[model samples]
Target chain A: MIRRRKIAEALFKLLSLSALALAIGTLVLLFGALMVDGLGRLDWQFLTSFPSRRASQAGILPAMVGSTLVMLVTACVGIPIGVAAGIYLEEYARRTWLTELIEVTVTNLAGVPSIIFGLLALGLFVYTLGLGPSILTAGLTLALLILPVVIVTTREAIRAIPVHIREAAFALGATKWQTVSDHVLPYSAAGILTGVILALSRAIGETAPIVTIGALTFIAFLPPAPVTSQPPYVSFEWLMSPFTVVPIQMFAWVSRPGEDFAANAAAAGLLLVGMTLVMNGLAIYVRYRMRKRVSW
Target chain B: MEIRETVSISHSSVMESASHRRARRRREFLIEGALLLAALVSVAATITILFVLVFESVGFFETVPLLDFLTDTLWTPLFDDPHYGILPLLAGTIVTSVVGLVVAIPVGTVSAVYLSEFASARLREIIKPVLEMLGAVPTVVYGYFALLVVTPALQWIWPELPGFNMLGPGVVIGIMILPLVISLSEDAMRAVPMMLREGSYAMGATRLQTAWRVVVPAATSGIVAAYVLGISRAVGETMVVAIAAGQNPNLTWNPMEPAATITAYIVQVALGDLPHGSIGYQSIFAAGLVLAVMTFAFNIVGHLMRKRFREVY
Candidate 1:
């Protein structure tokens, strides 16, 4: 009986260890495969040139530019609203029923699948507002997608501001906004930025929601300048333009039946992965700096 | 992941009435009012999402039979006598999701257990973050891997199966949600006190026995929550199924067959130029509503499990 038990235990341990190794094996192997498949194709033109009709001919430039523009717009729209709401929740709102409700709602929203946001964005921005399927509409969808993340993170940053500082400011007859703007916001800026960047990184690789709003899977056109150089730039008519983001473009390439398109998609995916890692790394570094400074 | 930040603004708001006596109470109210306004904005965002999905879904039912949508097996939306059955999509969702959970749960839960419990503190620290880094890798990237890599590999084993069968998407999604399951389950396991483990050890139980018999039951609720969350993620997953599990929406339970998930079908319909007010377009919203409600159910059950479980000291 004892021998049987010992043998069983040994087998179980081996199985579990192998399972552990398998999980790690998957990640390392995927990266290795991506590298082997994608390295020779990685070039300056891939980063700078336009996409094309054929796999050998296509480049990621237009898609990259569109992704960047959409991300910038999303960040611009999401940060202020999210941070303000976070500040309001953490700094000012009493722990009332409404506040609790908002807290729960925020958590639920975070779990709300990304694709649904695309649905809402289509209804609200694309159809109802007649903004059409454009960068601005995608931006709004991305903003809504990241709003809960920003609020949660900004709230944490705001809450990290010591109560004593608020006491000192109020004691000096500072108004509530003055206290928050002058004292808390600066202190929480680094943490809040980390949250925003992390949230944005998550948004950057997303292919589903934008695709739902018909984020053009293929577009040769570069993103128009942030402020269009043309007349009537601010009008609703301008918001109804075609847009192609990298993830969506990559998705298009990836789902193709051809091996060439698959290889191109892998190369594009490397770029997307690089983008995500950079965003996450930057977030970690910022938080580290903030932590070090605050510790001192 | 929801952290409670302890932000105490100086009790000075409460005490201001004593020192400065010119409608100080009103100023307090004003500050509170501003915060209330912001809170309302958040509340409104939540309401807006619910309203949009519900209203559009209502529009959907008016065009299609509610019963057939729920019960029928075929999912072709464009046939002149189109069958708007949701079963195929839901079945595809279940097959992939269950497969994903099967792959992830044991591996993830065990790894989490090892990280938070058995591994050395140094090893625990390293492994935990590395595992979480998996979570940070996006689903779209996972899709690329699943299609380009897993599908081809799978086809080798089951030559009869198409390249885009359910197995690849299911396996990929399992990998994608592994971090959540592991981390959350580990949190649950870690909360099990050292005394219980020691007692089992003292009674001559092996490490495996202690973990399975003592720690697991104690951590059961959290493990359940983790699984629920994983299912939610799998059900809501769009990119994996869209990329790896081919777009044909057939009603089949066979894992070897390539079928479309609810989200994949929505992506397919929305990917095309399906005119708004067309039956095809409304189907996307209808599918979205089902996906929304399904995930919502998973989340509520998960939250409730967390709430219901009380640790016995």
Candidate 2:
């Protein structure tokens, strides 16, 4: 009986270790395969030129530019609103049924599938509001998609500020807004910034919601220049211009038949994966450094 | 003389005038109002999503009978002679999700157990980020990997496996959701208090026995919540199935067959040039509503489970 029990324990340990190994091994395999297939395709030409009928001539220029512009809009619109909401929830709102309802709604929104967001954008933005599948619509769709993440992270960061700190500010004749802005916001900025970066990273790789809003898969030209030598140096024309993002571009290539297009898809995937990993790495590093510095 | 001059510095000048005080109060009030509006955006978003889905689906259900939508097996909204049965898509979703869960649950659970109960803290810190990276990888990339890599791999084991079978995407999804399951389950297991394990050890139980019998049972509700969330994720996953599983709406449970999930169908219709307000376009909203309802139900159950079992120690 003792021997049997010992053997069972050893077997269970082996099972557990192998389970972890399997997960790590898969990640290694994925990166290795992408490198082997796509490394040679990464070049200045590939970065600068427009996608072509011939797979060798194709580039990610238009797609990359569109992604950047869309991200700009998403950041501008999403971050301030998300941060304010977070501030309201953590710093100001009293515990009440209405706050509880909002909390539940936010949680539920976070779980709603990305594709559903796409459907919402289609009905609301594209048709009802007549945004017409522009970068603005895609940005708004993704802004809503990332709002819950931002809010949750912001709230957590604010909550981490010690109550004594807030009390001290209050005793110093600081109003609620003054305490939050001067104490809470500054203290939590690192955490909130990390969350923002992570959220943007997630949004960057999103394809379904963007695709559902009917992002064009093929675009040979970039949007109207955001900065130009013309009378008004900055332009809003790009917001309404048709756009294609990297993931959608990759998807288009992957669906087509041929080894050449497959290679291109692999190359695009490498770039997308690399970007998200870097952002995640940065977020982790920021959190680690902040935790080391702050005891309370 | 200098001390008297300093002492006599005007107190009234230092204090804010009534107008200034009122202005500051007004500013505070405006800021609060703005912040409240920002918080309400989430509520508005929820309401708008519901309205959009239901409104379009209402238009769709008007033409297609509700009974046929539920009971019929076919789903060909784009065909010349259209059928709006959602079962085929639903079947596809169930099959793939089941296959994914089969692979994920055991492996993820084991990994969680190891991380929470067995591994050293330093080892856990390293492993945790790597697992998070797996979740962070783009789904589009996973879709590509599923189509180009995993499917070819399965063909070696099963010679008759088609180019676009559900098995490849299902397995990849299992890998995709593995991190989620591991992290959430590990959190649950770790929350099982240390005294319970001590009690088991005092009773002459081995570490494995202690974890299996004591901690696992204690954290059962949380683990179940993790599983439910994983199921919701698998069901809603779009790109992997879209790229690997063929877009045919086949009503079968076989993992070896090609089929379209509800999400994949929505993508297909969106990619096409279906006119706005047409039956084909309207059909996607109907499909989306069903998808939303299913995931929403799972999420609520998971939420309740977590809430009910929290802080049990």
DockQ of each: 0.52, 0.85
Candidate 1 on A175-283: residue-level lDDT in tens?
7877888998998899999999999999998888899888877788765455656776554433456788888878888877787887788888888888888888798
Error of 1 at B82 (Å): 0.8
Q: What share of the true interface contacts does each candidate keep?
A: 0.52, 0.82
Tell me, by lDDT, which candidate is best: 2
Q: What lDDT score goes with residue B214 in model 2?
A: 91
DockQ of model 2, rounded to 2 decimals = 0.85
Please write out the lDDT profile of model 2 over residues A1-296, one tens digit for every residue: 89999999889989988989988988998998788888889889999989999999999999999999999999999999999999999987889987887799899999999999999999999999999999999999999999999999999998989999999999998888999999999999999999999999999999999999999998999899988898879999999999999999999999999998998999999999999999999999999999999976
Candidate 1 chain A: worst 10 consecutive residues by lDDT?
Answer: A232-241
Would you list the clashing residue pairs of candidate 1? none
Q: Predicted chain A of model 2: TM-score relative to the true chain A?
A: 0.98
Error at A282, model 2, angstroms: 0.9
Q: What would you estimate as the lDDT of candidate 2?
A: 0.93
Model 2 TM: 0.97
At residue B249, candidate 1 shows an lDDT of 88
